[model samples]
Target: MERTEKETTYQETRRVQKGDFAAAGQISASYKNMLKRLGVDSKVVRRLAIASYEAEINLAIHTLGGSMTIIVYPDHIFLVVEDTGPGIADIALAMQEGYSTAPEEVRMLGFGAGMGLPNMKRCSDTFEITSELGSGTTIRMGFNLLN
Candidate 1:
Protein backbone atom coordinates (compact mmCIF):
# COMPACT_ATOMS: atom_id res chain seq x y z
CA MET A 1 0.00 0.00 0.00
CA GLU A 2 1.20 3.50 -0.78
CA ARG A 3 1.26 5.94 2.11
CA THR A 4 0.44 9.59 1.87
CA GLU A 5 2.81 12.21 3.15
CA LYS A 6 1.91 15.46 4.78
CA GLU A 7 3.72 18.66 4.05
CA THR A 8 5.12 20.83 6.81
CA THR A 9 3.09 23.97 7.36
CA TYR A 10 5.49 25.82 9.65
CA GLN A 11 9.16 25.66 10.60
CA GLU A 12 11.70 27.58 12.67
CA THR A 13 15.41 27.12 13.34
CA ARG A 14 17.49 28.46 16.20
CA ARG A 15 21.26 28.47 16.55
CA VAL A 16 22.93 27.47 19.80
CA GLN A 17 26.44 28.50 20.72
CA LYS A 18 28.95 26.58 22.77
CA GLY A 19 29.08 27.28 26.50
CA ASP A 20 26.42 29.93 26.07
CA PHE A 21 25.08 29.50 29.56
CA ALA A 22 23.70 33.03 29.52
CA ALA A 23 21.41 32.12 26.64
CA ALA A 24 20.81 28.47 27.41
CA GLY A 25 17.07 28.43 27.55
CA GLN A 26 16.32 31.17 25.04
CA ILE A 27 15.45 28.94 22.10
CA SER A 28 13.13 26.73 24.11
CA ALA A 29 11.53 29.80 25.68
CA SER A 30 10.90 31.38 22.32
CA TYR A 31 9.39 28.22 20.95
CA LYS A 32 7.26 27.77 24.03
CA ASN A 33 5.94 31.31 23.63
CA MET A 34 5.22 30.73 19.98
CA LEU A 35 3.45 27.45 20.68
CA LYS A 36 1.34 29.20 23.29
CA ARG A 37 0.46 31.97 20.87
CA LEU A 38 -0.45 29.38 18.26
CA GLY A 39 -2.84 27.70 20.64
CA VAL A 40 -1.04 24.39 20.84
CA ASP A 41 -2.28 22.04 23.56
CA SER A 42 -0.87 22.91 26.97
CA LYS A 43 0.16 19.33 27.62
CA VAL A 44 1.99 19.15 24.34
CA VAL A 45 3.58 22.49 25.04
CA ARG A 46 4.73 21.33 28.42
CA ARG A 47 6.29 18.19 27.00
CA LEU A 48 8.04 20.10 24.27
CA ALA A 49 9.20 22.66 26.77
CA ILE A 50 10.85 20.03 28.94
CA ALA A 51 12.39 18.20 26.00
CA SER A 52 13.58 21.37 24.31
CA TYR A 53 15.12 22.72 27.47
CA GLU A 54 17.02 19.49 28.01
CA ALA A 55 18.28 19.42 24.45
CA GLU A 56 19.29 23.09 24.62
CA ILE A 57 21.18 22.53 27.84
CA ASN A 58 23.00 19.57 26.32
CA LEU A 59 24.13 21.66 23.40
CA ALA A 60 25.40 24.41 25.63
CA ILE A 61 27.21 22.10 27.99
CA HIS A 62 28.45 19.38 25.65
CA THR A 63 28.75 20.56 22.08
CA LEU A 64 30.80 23.22 20.39
CA GLY A 65 27.60 24.61 18.81
CA GLY A 66 24.53 23.55 16.92
CA SER A 67 21.11 24.39 15.57
CA MET A 68 17.67 23.32 16.63
CA THR A 69 14.86 23.15 14.14
CA ILE A 70 11.20 23.07 14.96
CA ILE A 71 8.74 21.82 12.42
CA VAL A 72 5.02 21.95 12.86
CA TYR A 73 2.42 20.00 10.95
CA PRO A 74 -1.22 19.24 11.34
CA ASP A 75 -0.54 16.11 13.35
CA HIS A 76 2.74 16.65 15.11
CA ILE A 77 5.49 18.93 16.33
CA PHE A 78 9.02 17.83 15.43
CA LEU A 79 12.30 18.96 16.95
CA VAL A 80 15.77 18.39 15.55
CA VAL A 81 18.85 19.16 17.61
CA GLU A 82 22.25 18.75 15.96
CA ASP A 83 25.58 19.61 17.51
CA THR A 84 29.22 19.58 16.55
CA GLY A 85 31.15 18.07 19.42
CA PRO A 86 32.53 14.88 20.81
CA GLY A 87 29.71 12.42 20.37
CA ILE A 88 28.64 9.75 22.80
CA ALA A 89 30.73 6.63 22.63
CA ASP A 90 28.08 4.45 24.19
CA ILE A 91 24.57 5.55 23.52
CA ALA A 92 23.12 2.76 25.63
CA LEU A 93 25.20 3.75 28.60
CA ALA A 94 24.44 7.40 28.10
CA MET A 95 20.75 6.70 28.10
CA GLN A 96 20.91 5.19 31.55
CA GLU A 97 19.62 7.43 34.30
CA GLY A 98 22.18 8.85 36.73
CA TYR A 99 25.07 7.97 34.40
CA SER A 100 26.81 11.12 33.20
CA THR A 101 30.11 12.08 31.69
CA ALA A 102 29.77 15.77 32.42
CA PRO A 103 32.78 17.60 33.71
CA GLU A 104 33.09 18.70 37.30
CA GLU A 105 32.25 22.31 36.53
CA VAL A 106 29.01 21.45 34.79
CA ARG A 107 28.07 19.14 37.63
CA MET A 108 28.80 21.93 40.10
CA LEU A 109 26.29 24.09 38.31
CA GLY A 110 23.60 21.51 39.08
CA PHE A 111 22.94 20.88 35.42
CA GLY A 112 24.35 17.46 34.55
CA ALA A 113 22.52 14.66 36.25
CA GLY A 114 22.55 12.33 33.24
CA MET A 115 18.84 12.71 32.83
CA GLY A 116 18.68 14.92 29.75
CA LEU A 117 18.37 12.29 27.04
CA PRO A 118 16.16 10.03 29.08
CA ASN A 119 13.88 12.92 29.97
CA MET A 120 13.66 14.02 26.38
CA LYS A 121 12.72 10.51 25.33
CA ARG A 122 10.15 10.30 28.05
CA CYS A 123 8.52 13.56 27.06
CA SER A 124 8.46 12.86 23.34
CA ASP A 125 6.05 10.74 21.41
CA THR A 126 8.96 9.61 19.30
CA PHE A 127 12.67 9.97 19.92
CA GLU A 128 15.83 9.02 18.02
CA ILE A 129 19.49 9.87 18.39
CA THR A 130 22.63 9.29 16.29
CA SER A 131 26.21 10.03 17.19
CA GLU A 132 29.70 9.73 15.81
CA LEU A 133 32.57 9.38 18.17
CA GLY A 134 34.69 12.34 17.11
CA SER A 135 32.15 14.13 14.98
CA GLY A 136 28.86 15.06 16.61
CA THR A 137 25.37 14.02 17.65
CA THR A 138 21.88 14.65 16.41
CA ILE A 139 18.64 14.09 18.26
CA ARG A 140 15.14 14.11 16.88
CA MET A 141 11.98 14.21 18.93
CA GLY A 142 8.35 14.37 17.95
CA PHE A 143 5.23 15.26 19.91
CA ASN A 144 1.93 14.15 18.51
CA LEU A 145 -0.79 16.76 18.62
CA LEU A 146 -3.52 14.19 18.36
CA ASN A 147 -2.47 12.56 21.59
Candidate 2:
Protein backbone atom coordinates (compact mmCIF):
# COMPACT_ATOMS: atom_id res chain seq x y z
CA MET A 1 0.00 0.00 0.00
CA GLU A 2 1.54 3.26 -1.06
CA ARG A 3 1.30 6.36 1.11
CA THR A 4 -1.82 8.44 0.79
CA GLU A 5 -2.97 11.12 3.22
CA LYS A 6 -0.97 11.78 6.36
CA GLU A 7 -2.31 9.49 9.06
CA THR A 8 -3.63 11.29 12.12
CA THR A 9 -3.81 9.34 15.36
CA TYR A 10 -3.08 9.78 19.03
CA GLN A 11 -3.57 8.41 22.51
CA GLU A 12 -4.94 10.16 25.57
CA THR A 13 -5.16 8.96 29.13
CA ARG A 14 -6.97 10.61 31.99
CA ARG A 15 -7.67 9.78 35.60
CA VAL A 16 -11.31 9.85 36.63
CA GLN A 17 -12.01 10.66 40.22
CA LYS A 18 -15.05 9.27 41.92
CA GLY A 19 -17.81 11.74 42.84
CA ASP A 20 -16.33 14.56 40.85
CA PHE A 21 -19.26 16.28 39.26
CA ALA A 22 -17.13 18.81 37.46
CA ALA A 23 -15.04 16.14 35.79
CA ALA A 24 -17.79 13.70 34.98
CA GLY A 25 -18.34 14.47 31.32
CA GLN A 26 -14.85 15.69 30.51
CA ILE A 27 -13.49 12.45 29.08
CA SER A 28 -16.43 11.90 26.79
CA ALA A 29 -16.21 15.44 25.51
CA SER A 30 -12.52 15.02 24.89
CA TYR A 31 -13.09 11.81 22.98
CA LYS A 32 -15.77 13.43 20.86
CA ASN A 33 -13.54 16.37 20.12
CA MET A 34 -10.71 14.10 19.04
CA LEU A 35 -12.94 12.23 16.68
CA LYS A 36 -14.31 15.45 15.25
CA ARG A 37 -10.79 16.73 14.74
CA LEU A 38 -9.91 13.58 12.83
CA GLY A 39 -12.86 14.19 10.50
CA VAL A 40 -14.41 10.87 11.38
CA ASP A 41 -17.77 10.14 9.87
CA SER A 42 -20.75 11.58 11.72
CA LYS A 43 -22.33 8.23 12.45
CA VAL A 44 -19.17 6.79 13.94
CA VAL A 45 -18.55 9.92 15.96
CA ARG A 46 -22.04 9.87 17.42
CA ARG A 47 -21.84 6.25 18.42
CA LEU A 48 -18.36 6.70 19.80
CA ALA A 49 -19.48 9.68 21.85
CA ILE A 50 -22.33 7.75 23.42
CA ALA A 51 -20.19 4.72 24.22
CA SER A 52 -17.35 6.82 25.55
CA TYR A 53 -19.62 8.83 27.82
CA GLU A 54 -21.39 5.80 29.20
CA ALA A 55 -18.11 4.14 30.09
CA GLU A 56 -16.73 7.33 31.54
CA ILE A 57 -19.78 7.82 33.74
CA ASN A 58 -19.62 4.23 34.91
CA LEU A 59 -16.00 4.71 35.96
CA ALA A 60 -16.68 7.97 37.75
CA ILE A 61 -19.81 6.90 39.56
CA HIS A 62 -19.38 3.20 40.30
CA THR A 63 -15.70 2.96 41.12
CA LEU A 64 -13.61 4.59 43.79
CA GLY A 65 -11.38 5.86 41.00
CA GLY A 66 -10.15 4.73 37.63
CA SER A 67 -8.47 5.60 34.39
CA MET A 68 -9.73 5.88 30.81
CA THR A 69 -7.50 5.71 27.77
CA ILE A 70 -8.51 6.45 24.20
CA ILE A 71 -6.41 5.10 21.35
CA VAL A 72 -7.17 6.64 18.00
CA TYR A 73 -6.19 4.63 14.96
CA PRO A 74 -6.66 4.83 11.22
CA ASP A 75 -9.75 2.70 10.99
CA HIS A 76 -11.05 2.53 14.53
CA ILE A 77 -10.92 3.92 18.04
CA PHE A 78 -10.30 1.90 21.19
CA LEU A 79 -11.33 2.68 24.71
CA VAL A 80 -10.22 1.06 27.93
CA VAL A 81 -11.67 1.78 31.32
CA GLU A 82 -10.00 0.17 34.32
CA ASP A 83 -11.02 0.51 37.93
CA THR A 84 -9.93 -0.89 41.29
CA GLY A 85 -13.27 -0.53 43.03
CA PRO A 86 -15.50 -3.35 44.18
CA GLY A 87 -15.72 -5.78 41.34
CA ILE A 88 -18.90 -6.97 39.74
CA ALA A 89 -19.62 -10.53 40.81
CA ASP A 90 -21.88 -11.41 37.90
CA ILE A 91 -21.04 -10.11 34.50
CA ALA A 92 -24.12 -11.64 32.95
CA LEU A 93 -26.45 -10.15 35.50
CA ALA A 94 -24.72 -6.82 35.25
CA MET A 95 -25.32 -6.79 31.53
CA GLN A 96 -29.01 -7.06 32.13
CA GLU A 97 -31.11 -3.93 32.09
CA GLY A 98 -32.22 -2.40 35.40
CA TYR A 99 -29.72 -4.49 37.36
CA SER A 100 -27.75 -1.82 39.13
CA THR A 101 -25.53 -1.94 42.16
CA ALA A 102 -25.58 1.78 42.59
CA PRO A 103 -26.25 3.16 46.03
CA GLU A 104 -29.42 5.02 46.97
CA GLU A 105 -27.63 8.35 46.93
CA VAL A 106 -26.38 7.72 43.46
CA ARG A 107 -29.87 6.87 42.33
CA MET A 108 -31.30 10.01 43.83
CA LEU A 109 -28.76 11.94 41.85
CA GLY A 110 -30.18 10.22 38.74
CA PHE A 111 -26.85 8.65 37.89
CA GLY A 112 -26.83 4.85 38.01
CA ALA A 113 -29.98 2.99 37.36
CA GLY A 114 -28.03 0.29 35.62
CA MET A 115 -27.83 0.67 31.79
CA GLY A 116 -24.16 1.58 31.59
CA LEU A 117 -22.69 -1.67 30.33
CA PRO A 118 -25.68 -2.36 28.16
CA ASN A 119 -25.49 1.08 26.60
CA MET A 120 -21.78 0.62 25.94
CA LYS A 121 -22.48 -2.60 24.09
CA ARG A 122 -25.22 -0.97 22.07
CA CYS A 123 -23.02 1.89 20.95
CA SER A 124 -19.83 0.08 20.10
CA ASP A 125 -19.09 -2.26 17.23
CA THR A 126 -17.29 -4.50 19.74
CA PHE A 127 -17.45 -4.58 23.52
CA GLU A 128 -15.95 -6.74 26.28
CA ILE A 129 -16.01 -6.58 30.04
CA THR A 130 -14.02 -8.54 32.63
CA SER A 131 -13.98 -8.39 36.38
CA GLU A 132 -13.01 -10.40 39.45
CA LEU A 133 -14.58 -10.54 42.89
CA GLY A 134 -11.95 -8.41 44.52
CA SER A 135 -9.75 -7.54 41.58
CA GLY A 136 -11.76 -4.74 40.03
CA THR A 137 -12.94 -4.42 36.44
CA THR A 138 -11.94 -3.50 32.94
CA ILE A 139 -14.22 -2.66 30.05
CA ARG A 140 -12.93 -2.53 26.51
CA MET A 141 -14.80 -1.04 23.59
CA GLY A 142 -13.96 -0.61 19.92
CA PHE A 143 -15.75 1.52 17.37
CA ASN A 144 -15.07 0.80 13.72
CA LEU A 145 -14.69 3.88 11.58
CA LEU A 146 -14.98 2.23 8.23
CA ASN A 147 -18.50 1.41 7.32
Candidate 3:
Protein backbone atom coordinates (compact mmCIF):
# COMPACT_ATOMS: atom_id res chain seq x y z
CA MET A 1 0.00 0.00 0.00
CA GLU A 2 1.47 3.28 -1.09
CA ARG A 3 0.32 6.60 0.29
CA THR A 4 1.10 10.12 -0.72
CA GLU A 5 2.38 12.74 1.68
CA LYS A 6 -0.76 14.78 1.13
CA GLU A 7 -2.85 12.19 2.94
CA THR A 8 -1.67 13.10 6.40
CA THR A 9 -4.10 12.76 9.32
CA TYR A 10 -4.03 13.94 12.90
CA GLN A 11 -4.06 11.15 15.47
CA GLU A 12 -3.47 11.85 19.16
CA THR A 13 -1.60 13.86 21.77
CA ARG A 14 -0.10 12.89 25.13
CA ARG A 15 1.48 14.90 27.93
CA VAL A 16 4.70 13.91 29.69
CA GLN A 17 5.94 15.12 33.05
CA LYS A 18 9.50 15.77 34.09
CA GLY A 19 11.34 13.50 36.54
CA ASP A 20 8.84 10.78 35.78
CA PHE A 21 11.38 7.99 35.64
CA ALA A 22 8.87 5.54 37.04
CA ALA A 23 6.60 6.22 34.07
CA ALA A 24 9.19 6.40 31.36
CA GLY A 25 8.00 5.06 27.99
CA GLN A 26 4.40 5.10 29.07
CA ILE A 27 3.42 7.46 26.25
CA SER A 28 5.26 5.41 23.66
CA ALA A 29 3.73 2.21 24.99
CA SER A 30 0.28 3.65 24.68
CA TYR A 31 1.01 5.05 21.25
CA LYS A 32 2.29 1.64 20.14
CA ASN A 33 -0.88 0.03 21.40
CA MET A 34 -2.96 2.59 19.53
CA LEU A 35 -1.10 2.00 16.32
CA LYS A 36 -1.42 -1.73 16.73
CA ARG A 37 -5.14 -1.33 17.19
CA LEU A 38 -5.26 0.75 14.04
CA GLY A 39 -3.62 -2.09 12.10
CA VAL A 40 -0.47 -0.12 11.30
CA ASP A 41 2.51 -2.04 9.94
CA SER A 42 4.64 -3.72 12.58
CA LYS A 43 7.90 -2.27 11.28
CA VAL A 44 6.52 1.25 11.31
CA VAL A 45 5.10 0.66 14.75
CA ARG A 46 8.48 -0.54 15.93
CA ARG A 47 10.28 2.52 14.68
CA LEU A 48 7.69 4.86 16.17
CA ALA A 49 7.95 3.02 19.46
CA ILE A 50 11.69 3.37 19.59
CA ALA A 51 11.72 7.02 18.60
CA SER A 52 8.88 7.93 20.89
CA TYR A 53 10.48 6.16 23.84
CA GLU A 54 13.74 7.97 23.28
CA ALA A 55 12.00 11.34 23.12
CA GLU A 56 9.99 10.57 26.21
CA ILE A 57 13.04 9.53 28.19
CA ASN A 58 14.92 12.65 27.16
CA LEU A 59 12.09 14.79 28.45
CA ALA A 60 11.83 12.96 31.74
CA ILE A 61 15.51 12.68 32.41
CA HIS A 62 16.68 16.00 31.05
CA THR A 63 13.80 18.47 30.94
CA LEU A 64 11.55 20.00 33.54
CA GLY A 65 8.38 19.05 31.59
CA GLY A 66 7.07 18.38 28.11
CA SER A 67 4.49 16.78 25.83
CA MET A 68 4.37 14.21 23.05
CA THR A 69 2.00 14.40 20.11
CA ILE A 70 1.31 11.68 17.56
CA ILE A 71 -0.09 12.54 14.15
CA VAL A 72 -0.96 9.71 11.85
CA TYR A 73 -1.54 9.96 8.14
CA PRO A 74 -2.21 7.41 5.44
CA ASP A 75 1.50 7.32 4.66
CA HIS A 76 3.31 8.40 7.79
CA ILE A 77 3.34 8.97 11.52
CA PHE A 78 4.60 12.27 12.90
CA LEU A 79 5.87 12.79 16.43
CA VAL A 80 6.40 16.21 18.01
CA VAL A 81 8.07 16.50 21.40
CA GLU A 82 8.33 19.85 23.13
CA ASP A 83 9.86 20.41 26.53
CA THR A 84 10.51 23.17 29.01
CA GLY A 85 13.93 22.50 30.45
CA PRO A 86 17.56 23.42 30.10
CA GLY A 87 17.99 23.41 26.36
CA ILE A 88 20.88 21.83 24.53
CA ALA A 89 23.72 24.25 24.02
CA ASP A 90 25.15 22.25 21.18
CA ILE A 91 22.78 20.13 19.15
CA ALA A 92 25.62 18.77 17.07
CA LEU A 93 27.48 17.60 20.12
CA ALA A 94 24.29 16.15 21.56
CA MET A 95 23.75 14.15 18.39
CA GLN A 96 27.06 12.39 18.70
CA GLU A 97 26.80 8.84 19.93
CA GLY A 98 28.12 8.32 23.48
CA TYR A 99 28.07 12.07 24.16
CA SER A 100 25.74 12.89 27.02
CA THR A 101 25.32 15.53 29.69
CA ALA A 102 23.28 13.28 31.93
CA PRO A 103 24.31 13.35 35.55
CA GLU A 104 26.24 10.53 37.18
CA GLU A 105 23.14 9.24 38.92
CA VAL A 106 21.25 8.99 35.63
CA ARG A 107 24.10 7.06 34.05
CA MET A 108 24.13 4.78 37.06
CA LEU A 109 20.44 4.10 36.43
CA GLY A 110 21.37 2.69 33.00
CA PHE A 111 20.37 5.67 30.84
CA GLY A 112 22.01 8.87 29.48
CA ALA A 113 24.54 6.93 27.43
CA GLY A 114 24.30 9.80 24.93
CA MET A 115 22.22 7.72 22.58
CA GLY A 116 18.87 9.47 22.95
CA LEU A 117 19.12 11.90 20.06
CA PRO A 118 21.12 9.57 17.88
CA ASN A 119 18.73 6.71 18.46
CA MET A 120 15.74 8.90 17.76
CA LYS A 121 17.26 10.11 14.51
CA ARG A 122 18.15 6.59 13.53
CA CYS A 123 14.62 5.33 14.06
CA SER A 124 12.82 8.11 12.28
CA ASP A 125 12.53 8.66 8.55
CA THR A 126 12.95 12.37 9.29
CA PHE A 127 14.19 13.98 12.49
CA GLU A 128 14.88 17.54 13.61
CA ILE A 129 15.70 19.06 16.98
CA THR A 130 15.97 22.71 17.98
CA SER A 131 16.92 24.14 21.34
CA GLU A 132 17.84 27.32 23.13
CA LEU A 133 20.44 27.65 25.84
CA GLY A 134 18.06 27.96 28.81
CA SER A 135 14.57 27.87 27.31
CA GLY A 136 13.95 24.28 26.16
CA THR A 137 13.94 21.88 23.20
CA THR A 138 11.59 20.67 20.53
CA ILE A 139 12.02 17.58 18.41
CA ARG A 140 10.03 16.70 15.33
CA MET A 141 10.21 13.19 13.96
CA GLY A 142 8.43 11.54 11.07
CA PHE A 143 8.13 7.79 10.40
CA ASN A 144 6.90 6.45 7.12
CA LEU A 145 4.01 4.03 7.36
CA LEU A 146 4.37 2.74 3.83
CA ASN A 147 7.82 1.30 3.30
Candidate 4:
Protein backbone atom coordinates (compact mmCIF):
# COMPACT_ATOMS: atom_id res chain seq x y z
CA MET A 1 0.00 0.00 0.00
CA GLU A 2 2.58 2.51 -1.04
CA ARG A 3 1.77 5.62 -3.00
CA THR A 4 2.94 6.03 -6.53
CA GLU A 5 4.55 9.15 -7.95
CA LYS A 6 1.49 9.98 -9.97
CA GLU A 7 -0.58 10.15 -6.82
CA THR A 8 1.65 12.59 -4.98
CA THR A 9 0.61 16.22 -5.20
CA TYR A 10 3.58 17.72 -3.38
CA GLN A 11 6.60 16.81 -1.29
CA GLU A 12 9.32 18.52 0.71
CA THR A 13 12.27 17.54 2.83
CA ARG A 14 14.09 19.33 5.62
CA ARG A 15 17.26 18.62 7.55
CA VAL A 16 17.23 18.65 11.31
CA GLN A 17 20.36 19.17 13.38
CA LYS A 18 20.73 17.82 16.85
CA GLY A 19 20.31 20.48 19.53
CA ASP A 20 19.62 23.14 16.94
CA PHE A 21 17.43 25.40 19.00
CA ALA A 22 17.05 27.97 16.24
CA ALA A 23 15.66 25.42 13.79
CA ALA A 24 13.50 23.50 16.23
CA GLY A 25 10.12 24.34 14.71
CA GLN A 26 11.15 25.11 11.17
CA ILE A 27 10.09 21.78 9.70
CA SER A 28 6.65 21.81 11.23
CA ALA A 29 6.12 25.46 10.45
CA SER A 30 7.11 25.00 6.84
CA TYR A 31 4.75 22.08 6.47
CA LYS A 32 1.91 23.94 8.11
CA ASN A 33 2.42 26.92 5.86
CA MET A 34 2.47 24.79 2.77
CA LEU A 35 -0.74 23.04 3.74
CA LYS A 36 -2.46 26.31 4.44
CA ARG A 37 -1.36 27.66 1.09
CA LEU A 38 -2.72 24.56 -0.57
CA GLY A 39 -6.11 25.07 1.12
CA VAL A 40 -5.93 21.88 3.06
CA ASP A 41 -8.53 21.50 5.78
CA SER A 42 -7.83 23.15 9.07
CA LYS A 43 -8.35 19.97 11.08
CA VAL A 44 -5.85 18.01 9.01
CA VAL A 45 -3.36 20.82 9.07
CA ARG A 46 -3.72 21.18 12.81
CA ARG A 47 -3.20 17.48 13.37
CA LEU A 48 -0.16 17.49 11.13
CA ALA A 49 1.22 20.59 12.80
CA ILE A 50 1.00 19.06 16.24
CA ALA A 51 2.51 15.75 15.17
CA SER A 52 5.20 17.36 13.04
CA TYR A 53 6.21 19.70 15.83
CA GLU A 54 6.60 16.83 18.23
CA ALA A 55 8.52 14.90 15.60
CA GLU A 56 10.73 17.90 14.98
CA ILE A 57 11.49 18.38 18.66
CA ASN A 58 12.18 14.68 19.12
CA LEU A 59 14.64 14.74 16.26
CA ALA A 60 16.41 17.80 17.56
CA ILE A 61 16.52 16.89 21.24
CA HIS A 62 16.91 13.15 21.05
CA THR A 63 18.96 12.10 18.05
CA LEU A 64 22.36 13.14 16.73
CA GLY A 65 20.70 14.49 13.59
CA GLY A 66 18.00 13.63 11.10
CA SER A 67 15.86 14.60 8.14
CA MET A 68 12.10 14.87 7.85
CA THR A 69 10.12 14.61 4.65
CA ILE A 70 6.45 15.24 3.98
CA ILE A 71 4.55 13.90 1.01
CA VAL A 72 1.10 15.11 0.16
CA TYR A 73 -1.43 13.06 -1.73
CA PRO A 74 -4.98 13.85 -2.71
CA ASP A 75 -6.37 11.94 0.25
CA HIS A 76 -3.40 11.37 2.50
CA ILE A 77 -0.29 12.96 3.94
CA PHE A 78 2.75 11.00 4.97
CA LEU A 79 5.68 11.99 7.14
CA VAL A 80 8.92 10.05 7.24
CA VAL A 81 11.69 10.99 9.68
CA GLU A 82 15.09 9.37 9.98
CA ASP A 83 17.79 10.14 12.49
CA THR A 84 21.53 9.57 12.60
CA GLY A 85 22.44 7.60 15.73
CA PRO A 86 21.90 7.00 19.44
CA GLY A 87 18.63 5.28 18.83
CA ILE A 88 15.99 4.01 21.18
CA ALA A 89 16.30 0.59 22.77
CA ASP A 90 12.68 -0.02 23.57
CA ILE A 91 9.95 1.17 21.26
CA ALA A 92 7.17 0.00 23.57
CA LEU A 93 8.51 1.86 26.57
CA ALA A 94 9.12 4.98 24.54
CA MET A 95 5.49 4.95 23.42
CA GLN A 96 4.41 5.45 26.99
CA GLU A 97 3.12 8.99 27.48
CA GLY A 98 5.22 9.94 30.50
CA TYR A 99 8.33 7.90 29.62
CA SER A 100 11.36 9.78 28.41
CA THR A 101 15.11 9.45 27.99
CA ALA A 102 15.74 13.17 27.62
CA PRO A 103 18.35 14.65 29.89
CA GLU A 104 17.83 17.38 32.43
CA GLU A 105 19.25 19.96 30.09
CA VAL A 106 16.54 19.40 27.49
CA ARG A 107 13.86 19.33 30.13
CA MET A 108 15.02 22.63 31.54
CA LEU A 109 14.41 24.16 28.13
CA GLY A 110 10.67 23.57 28.64
CA PHE A 111 10.66 20.54 26.38
CA GLY A 112 11.35 16.80 26.54
CA ALA A 113 8.36 16.32 28.80
CA GLY A 114 8.03 12.74 27.49
CA MET A 115 5.09 13.57 25.21
CA GLY A 116 6.67 13.63 21.79
CA LEU A 117 6.08 10.10 20.59
CA PRO A 118 2.68 9.88 22.19
CA ASN A 119 1.58 13.12 20.61
CA MET A 120 2.74 11.98 17.22
CA LYS A 121 0.84 8.75 17.57
CA ARG A 122 -2.25 10.48 18.81
CA CYS A 123 -2.32 12.98 15.96
CA SER A 124 -1.76 10.55 13.13
CA ASP A 125 -4.03 7.94 11.65
CA THR A 126 -1.09 5.61 11.21
CA PHE A 127 2.11 5.63 13.26
CA GLU A 128 5.17 3.44 13.13
CA ILE A 129 8.54 3.74 14.78
CA THR A 130 11.60 1.52 14.44
CA SER A 131 14.80 2.13 16.33
CA GLU A 132 18.08 0.37 16.85
CA LEU A 133 19.99 1.24 19.98
CA GLY A 134 23.30 2.13 18.31
CA SER A 135 22.14 3.05 14.83
CA GLY A 136 19.14 5.37 14.64
CA THR A 137 15.37 5.65 14.46
CA THR A 138 12.76 6.02 11.75
CA ILE A 139 9.24 7.21 12.34
CA ARG A 140 6.50 7.17 9.74
CA MET A 141 3.18 8.86 10.33
CA GLY A 142 0.21 8.99 7.98
CA PHE A 143 -2.82 11.24 8.11
CA ASN A 144 -6.07 11.08 6.24
CA LEU A 145 -7.37 14.13 4.43
CA LEU A 146 -10.89 14.00 5.70
CA ASN A 147 -11.71 17.40 4.39
Return whichever of 1 and 2 wins on lDDT: 1
Query: Which digits, one per residue and each the tens of the lDDT, describe model 1 over residues 105-137?
Result: 988888999999999999999999999988999
The TM-score values for the models, in the order shown, are 0.93, 0.90, 0.91, 0.95
Residues 22-122, candidate 4, lDDT per residue (tens digit)? Answer: 67997798899999999999899999999999989988888899999999999899999999889998889999989988889988888888888999999
lDDT score, candidate 1, position 141: 95
Q: Model 2, range 21-125, lDDT digits (tens) per residue?
A: 557887888778877888989888888888888777787778878899887779878888999877898999999989998888877877788888898999989
What do the candidate models score in CA lDDT, each in turn? Answer: 0.90, 0.83, 0.87, 0.90
User: RMSD (Cα, Å) of candidate 1?
Assistant: 2.5
**Model 3 regions more than 4 Å off:** 1-10
- Give lDDT tens digits, candidate 3, residues 6-108: 6756566777888888898888999989899989999889988998998888889999898998888877788999998789988999999999988988888
Using TM-score as the measure, which candidate wins?
A: 4
Model 4 residue 124 distance off true place after TM-score fit, in angstroms = 0.3
Candidate 1 TM-score, true structure as reference: 0.93
After TM-score superposition, what is the CA distance of residue 24 in candidate 1 from its true location, in Å?
0.3
